[model samples]
Target chain A: MKKIISVLLAAAMAFALAACGGAQSSAPASSAPAASSAAPGQSSSVAAYATSLDDIKVKGELVIGLDDTFAPMGFRDENGDLVGFDIDLATAVCEVLGVKPVFQPIDWDAKELELSTGKIDCIWNGMSITPEREQSMSLSNAYLNNKIIIMTNKGVTIASKDDLANYNLGTQADSSALEVVKGDPIYDSIKDKLTEYKTYDQVIMDMQAGRIDAMIVDEVLGQYKNTQLGNVFEVAPVDFGEDLYAIGLRKSDTELTDAINAAMKTCIDSGTAAEISTKWFGSDIMVK
Target chain B: MNLSYIATLMPALMQGLAQTLKLFALTLIFSLPLGLVFTLGSISRVPPLRWVSRIYIWIFRGTPLMLQLFFIYYGLPFMGLTFDRFPAAVLTFVLNYAAYFAEIYRAGIQSIDRGQHEAAKTLGFTPWQTMRYIIIPQTVSRVIPPVCNETITLVKDTALVTAIGVGELLKAAQGAVNRDVNITAYAVAALIYLAITFVMTMAYERLERYFSRHQKKEG
Candidate 1:
């Protein structure tokens, strides 16, 4: 026992030495200034970030935060490479900005902190335009339109939003679809049946497992999943409402926000955005 | 069940396993010795050392590990100190596990018969020598089973690193499941975790045997 303890003590000393060298060398110098400097009681600093292309040019990369599980917008492929419309669009935008795009997969719950702490420059996934979001972050021009689509398991009945109350419903919590569903006139009727899961994929799984008879999801994701799943889920005839997808930037990042919007507009005009949109959605769904 | 699908996922899952193993290994390396220091501090005769160690253990063990991860990773930035995500995760885990291990060690050490210490003193064994040569050696054999239990828990607890965006194995499986719209990746991840814990269980068994064999000889 003493021999093993002595050996482990020796190894621990060695590990401590190696960790300081290897770990420090691997982390980027630019990412180290991640402190928010917000006073303890306050949530965030109100000081404007005085950065334009110069700071980004110096850093040489734009770290964009996103929830990588979102499909058709930004999600990993089978090879675990990031794909989907938003990623392609971001890559193109980064080409225009003369900086590399570094996609940082983040916890969706921590997106705002990621931006405020300078961990990521912006949230570039399929973020929906909401009043609360617009108040918190400077939103870019709405690039894509999404609808809250209701999907039910096969061999289920009826039509329209009224019939939705008859079946147990599910959706990802904190989703744009959930926001729309909660505000819908029929939500009062279906409120008892709605089950909010952590992700749309989980909601789809529950629908498949027969735990949930139907799932409310974003149209882009629903269409993508329906195509992929192949005859598993049926989209209800009634669409809940529309949601506009936009880029979310820290409120202080007005210059960066303008840069992204200008780049997006250029992509839409030059047919690049349409090309990527067509590839992902089978049509040009860009908000041109 | 689908061999081809599992094959497609192997590379990503293996990448994630590498990350899990790194965290698990690092936490074990740091926590084991650090835990011993706390155990000693917690059980010491000195008033200040014991109280400080007891307080450290109380704060860490009393709070949820997830909350600690959050405060360290997200909250600490307010005070101008910061750690990158993986480092923050490793720090939280090391600190949290060290507290638990301290308690476990304290229990094992205190359980030893007090007569041994008195005998060591009679033989001119200083306090340090009495602990080093008599008390600690005996506690080692007794502590093995509980330490094994804690070590096994650490294997599964690595999954919680996903909360801090560390991309451990379960998160990797989740990414695959989200992309493919299938549950197969989850099943594969479960098997992988089981395999790790199974190996750990076997190693601990061998360790227990080796110690007990020596323990019997000493007896």
Candidate 2:
């Protein structure tokens, strides 16, 4: 009886191993159909986009990717529900396109890969338009005017960019704000004292603790965080030039890009965009 | 593959390595002694002490260390306790590792022969003296292999602190990759890790040999 039980245990282990192997081998087989189905579209240069407007419509959902920690744009509220300016705008855009809006929170750093892999139909977050991004992704026309600004704890004072040389600064890594800071001529003097955090939230925390004297951040995000946190931060007047925020889609998704641009223009022109903007920012800051 | 590019990355990667080594060293220093205390507590005659030790081991061992780091660094601020990044990372590492090391120590202690305890008792050795002279010395040798395994794991696990933006070796490699859009920095980081583990393996082998020197030689 003991021998029989041992044999049965061995067989069970073998069966489990075989089952895992079968599942592993079948994963690629499952994706094979989707690739084969896209072969015809692949041959036609016109339908070369991994996903198209018609495809998204047929699917009945537009998966909009964003970093949910970014406030006033696409972030979670106190109740853990996603609510922000971009959240409202994307929903409106999806409404115009006649598809359900699906917000997929993604690692902000991996947003490009998310778009390329078709994990997200588009990045509709307050993504700043940059040359590097322009080369990689098909971007909609500028929808929001943004600027990188210096923010400090309420008592901390900084008058100009040159004054930044004296303070220990923080900025989010892989961010456009960091890019602007690094590009600035003053960066060389203060570069040694700069800390790159994973998110603006951490930067704000460090600022509150007096670990970092100031944070270089997007105007929209900095204002939102400052207001949300009971105005514990003071915005420095030092500007890092204008940065335009736009929607990012896969490079091949030209038709979808056009569709989104048109939809965005309609949102701006119809006063619906202004109403949404007013609801979030207390003013209609939507691009005319 | 570009030599100049690799050279440019070396400084940042070395800085990251320095941070990783600091974390590994500090964790080992604090966790090893604390682990011994925990092992003793878990085996104590007192129910409350044993239960506390057991529950700590259960919680730390069962949950992911990443969550602990997040809780200590991020979540704690909500309840009025806050720690800076490096301290929080080190504190979390020390706590998490002590639980693991405690289990290893317990296993090592329990594996000692019953005859040794009996002999020690017969020789007028008190419980404390028996543990100090006979049990612990033997347990050290028995535990070295598992302890070495855990030490190597600790070296790799230092990368998880990057979740809290501590910027250790792996995060530095990722930063380099992001900056240059090349993967060569990762290869460099991998080699650095390999060098560390290789040295650790050699050291542990020597330790094993040193510990087993008194064992009867095989013909």
CA lDDT of each prediction against the hidden true structure? 0.82, 0.78
lDDT of 1 at A188: 93
- Docking category of candidate 1: incorrect
The numbered model that scores best in TM-score is 1
In model 1, the runs with Cα more than 4 Å from the true position are A1-43, A46-51, B217-219
Task: Give the residue spans of candidate 2 off by over 4 A.
Answer: A1-49, B1-219
TM-score of chain A of each: 0.82, 0.81
Error of 1 at B171 (Å): 1.0
lDDT by residue for model 1 (B115-175), tens: 9889989999999999898888888888899999998999899998886678878988998
Worst 10 residues of 1 chain A by lDDT: A34-43
lDDT of each residue in A1-288, candidate 1, tens digit only: 976875576456546644653343222221222221112211236243335667898999998898887777787776779988899999999998889999998888667667766678889999888766777677899999788888889877649888987888898877788878877788899999999888888888788889889888888888788888886888778888888999988776788889888988888899999999889888888898
User: Per-residue lDDT for A132-217 in model 2, tens only?
Assistant: 67766789999887788889877777988888888899998777898777777888998998998876766876887789999999
